[model samples]
Target: MSEPVKVREGAAGASDDKPGFDLGSGPGRLLVWLYGVFTVAAASRSVVQVILDFGRAPLAYVLSAVAAVVYAFITYSLVRGGETARKAALVCCAAELAGVLVVGTWTLVEPSAFPDATVWSDYGMGYLFIPVILPVTAMVWLRRSARR
Candidate 1:
């Protein structure tokens, strides 16, 4: 008889982790890598904005920090994929969608309000629309990992 395919469990019962390495499994590494990138990006942007010229556009600068916070949340949630993180990802991604849409429209119709920039400013035109893409991908990722 052929050997049965063993359903091995991971160290923490991480359902989606592949064999050989816990962290190197499937989208796990990708998620980790992306999160690290976003964390650095958002942190740096916020730091530069606040330190260099917080007075220039207080509203936009503060929103940049908030955007960074949301990105940070998304990154952490993706890396720490679990039942809770999945839900959090959904929420964060949804919020990102709202922010992008609202700010995109605002920047389009009422350009004067946004003297400074944010992740959602100009419909993410500044970031080559990556800001718009991240949340959608995050939602899909959460759904895929949800089946774990």
Candidate 2:
């Protein structure tokens, strides 16, 4: 008779040394997809505006570019799928939330301040508030993943 193969389980039933849940799986997958889409959307919009008429709304254009960078970094971190990446993504998500709040309030308080809208203008009202909501969701996911 052939011998039966036995599988070894590590601590907490994990078979490997990885310390956290996969950041790119389950709901994280949706977050990654959303971030990726935002990155592309914000990047393209900023690039076109900066190239065509940056003087028209320099602050708005710059902020859009900043949003794009933040989105890209979060997406990368989520896809990386490790403890370090989870921490980094958490920090970035916090920053992103702060930026959205600050810019959203600024735009509301002083409409003239931004002749055009950035990705985060009005808490991402233009983009259906996804900009504001995404960071919070990502932060929660990252934190939860850390405990796994």
Candidate 3:
């Protein structure tokens, strides 16, 4: 007689649901790393700008702070890696894209409006356009990961 296989109760593989959706796998790992880097860069830039001279360009400084916040949230949500977090990341990414386009255009149309450069200025020219590209990439990753 042969012994039968035994499945562990409450184990992730034993259940229909996946072992929790992790956004830090495969390609997503790169996304996560990039997001992390951006979070630090944006936050540090904004803090220094806001503290050093709030009057030079209030609008640009505030916008940079907002970008930092958005980046931090998206990075957190991605690392958290759950359905709710994924949805939050999706929403934030879309907002980030919109911010980039608006800021980029505004900087071009009215150079006087921004006395200083933001993360999204000139479509993220200061950061090699990574600010504009990161959100789009994150959105795609989030969508594909949801399906898998």
TM-score between candidate 3 and the true structure:
0.87
At residue 116, give the lDDT of candidate 1: 83
How well does candidate 1 match the true structure, expressed as C-alpha RMSD? 4.3
Candidate with better lDDT, 1 vs 2 = 2
* Model 2 TM-score (2 dp): 0.90
After superposition, the stretches of candidate 3 with alpha carbons farther than 4 Å from their true spots are 1-20
Best by lDDT: 2
Which ranges of candidate 2 are over 4 A from the true structure? Answer: 1-19
lDDT, each prediction: 0.73, 0.92, 0.87
* Per-candidate count of clashing residue pairs (backbone under 3 Å): 0, 0, 0
Q: Write down the worst ten-residue block by lDDT for model 3.
A: 12-21
Q: Estimated TM-score per prediction?
A: 0.78, 0.90, 0.87
Model 2 worst lDDT window (10 residues): 8-17
- Please give the RMSD to the true structure for each candidate, in Å: 4.3, 2.8, 3.1
Against the true structure, candidate 1 reaches a TM-score of 0.78
Rank candidates by TM-score, best first: 2, 3, 1
